[model samples]
Target: MKTDNSALARRLGLYFVMLWFSIGGIGHFVATGTFASIVPPYLSDPYALVYVSGAFELLGVIGLMILRTRRIAGIGLFLLTIAVTPANVQMWLHPELYPIMPQWVYLLRLFAQVGLLACIWWSTRPAPKAEGIRNGPQFP
Candidate 1:
């Protein structure tokens, strides 16, 4: 019996995102107060927004785990990444706000965000069609 490598890759990719976002969701839950503190000052109520965003992340991760909803989940995650860019920019702009973590840690987080965005992009990308000599009727 031969195994389809693409299928395996897809499963691995799905599992990777599932685990990655799950951990992020947990971190948000565990450090909601800290994360709220890190929210940009422009937000009217950073604490409420942080928790709401955390809930969305947790739900998105759970949705991504199911095959039927994988595409939607990927889309949601992609939007979430884009939506959070302000925070990334704010962190880079004001490192002192994240004093609990080293400067390098915040930079690493930004890079990791890029990686996650790439992964989500790869996962939701349409599979390429197989190309082979046509087995249909041909001119003699």
Candidate 2:
């Protein structure tokens, strides 16, 4: 039996992302008002949207944990991030609305989402080919 470091690293990355989202989802319920406050003014029913996003986050975490569901989960979470971009934008445009954090933090969060998407894609992608002889080569 042999261990593949790349595969192990991907799995660890997946788990780390899952844990991060799980906590965020739970926070939606625990601090509904805080999450709702970030919703863009144009969106109606901020509280409901917050809870709905929380549900999807939990679902995405479950999907990421299962081997068969990882791809879908990655896709879903990626879309979810896109969907929530409006809120991020709102925060950036109206820093006065969310006084708890400085204006610059919201800008960084937009970039962070891109990194998170890349991590999710890398972690959920198909396993790499095993190290060995190639189709037309044989050594020793």
Candidate 3:
């Protein structure tokens, strides 16, 4: 038996994204206060922002699972990750404010977010169609 490693990797990546967002989306509702605390003060209505982002996260997960919707979902999720950079930045900028972990951990999260974006972009991309000469029906 032979294995197609690229296909395997892509499948794993897609599942990772789905699971990550699914849990995070649920967390947004279940632990609204904890998620809301991460929101930067500059933003208005922390709760609303949290809810909206959470809803988007869940939507993205659904879109990711369906082949027809994967592309749009990847795009939306990529932008969402970018959109939340500021909150991550704030966490890094002032460790005193958010004591959830050490300063290094917050900084590591910023880096991890970049990796996450890359994963979403690469994994959700449509697989290339196989190429071969037609067995029949030849034409210009």
Best by TM-score: 3
Error of 1 at 59 (Å): 1.4
RMSD list, candidates in order? 7.9, 6.2, 6.6
Candidate 3 vs. true structure, TM-score: 0.89
TM-scores for all predictions: 0.78, 0.87, 0.89
Which ranges in model 1 have alpha carbons more than 4 Å from their true place? 129-140
- lDDT per residue, candidate 3, 1-140, as tens digits? 23256666766888888888899899999999988888999999999998999999999999887777887898999999898888899899999988869999999999999999999887787664431212211112
Model 3: residues with Cα > 4 Å off, grouped in runs: 1-3, 130-140
Better model by lDDT, 1 or 2?
2
The candidate with the higher TM-score, 1 or 2, is 2
The ten-residue window of minimal lDDT in model 2 covers 131-140
Q: Which sequence of candidate numbers ranks them by lDDT, best first?
A: 3, 2, 1
Error of 2 at 107 (Å): 0.6
TM-score leaderboard ranking: 3, 2, 1
lDDT of 1 by residue, 1-140 (tens): 23356644655676787787788778788898877777788887887777778888889987765656667878898898888878887887788877776777788888988988988876654444431112211112
| Top candidate (lDDT) | 3
Residue range 1-140, candidate 2, lDDT tens digits: 34467656766777777887899889999999998999998899999999999999999999876767777887898889889999999998999988989999999999998888888777766665662212211112
